[model samples]
Target: MAIPNEALRKVLMEIEQKSIQSSQQIQLVKAQIAAKKRESRILQLTASEVGVLPSGTAVYEGVGKMFIQTPPSDVMLRLEKEGSDLKNDVTNLEKKLHYLETTYTNSRNSFEQILTRAGGSV
Candidate 1:
């Protein structure tokens, strides 16, 4: 099937927006992970003050109880893999966004020139 340049341009714009959004999401994930790390540190330090969190309970001092997660040895490995994947995706998306911006800029410039030739055709 054939596609018009305008349609293709719109599609590219959409792709660029999505990539920018994905990059933002990646940043958010990194922030949340940092927050989780801080929370974990707090839990470890306050564990004694909060007193053993009692495996069966969910709340103490207006906060949820903390339970240890016993994941398979590969959990960290998988998380590292996912982090690597996300970083790569963010990088690729940034590159694509740059290309899309350049393409859109060039296309608009070309169209503006065309209009100029037509004497205020725009």
Candidate 2:
């Protein structure tokens, strides 16, 4: 079916906007994934370093604005748990990123088809 030029232009603009929004969302998700991976890596390094400490060594854990004395084993446990959680978060974010990328690609393809139908070039 053929659409009037004005209507086609409006539809094209809406599709372009959707594509841009999807692109932005994909970028944001990618950044979040990177940050999560970095955090996970830091946790692993911290755990490894802490592992080398003497068995009776004192460990301090930061809570809010204060550092409280904590057992080395407890600190290691917390780090391990946090690292696991961060890994899960990264996995979820990666799935979201994939979805956003697929949406962005589909929007671009649709936009191109609309332009072609309207005797226009992208």
Candidate 3:
């Protein structure tokens, strides 16, 4: 059985649209990774200077729209943990984005081949 040109065209269009959406998602994920990396760098820097601050030094932590006084030691530990979590999240997102891109490319190529066989321009 042979597929119709119209059906092939529709499938190709759908695949192209999905590819575009996947590309957009990848860009968003990349931006998130960049932001997370910046945050992680700042945290690492702060953690490195943990011994410099005086015991009585004042530190404020942001909680929503309010800032609460917090211990520097507590802040240092929290920052290190949060940075590690963000790094892990970025890694997982990168893997997912890679998979999406690979699948999108394969689907687009297959659709293009079908369209070509149907005497249609991709």
In order, the Cα lDDT scores of the candidates are 0.52, 0.90, 0.81
lDDT of 2 by residue, 34-107 (tens): 99988998999999999999989988888999999998899999998999899889989989988999999999
Task: Report the number of clashing residue pairs per model.
Answer: 0, 0, 0
Candidate order, TM-score descending: 2, 3, 1
lDDT pick, better of 2 and 3: 2
Regions more than 4 Å wrong, model 3: 54-56, 63-67, 119-122
| Local accuracy of candidate 1 as per-residue lDDT tens digits, 2-118 | 445576556556655665665566566556556655655554455443344444454323225664443333333444555566556656656665665566566556555544554
Tally clashing residue pairs in candidate 1: 0
Q: How accurate is candidate 2 locally (lDDT)?
A: 0.90
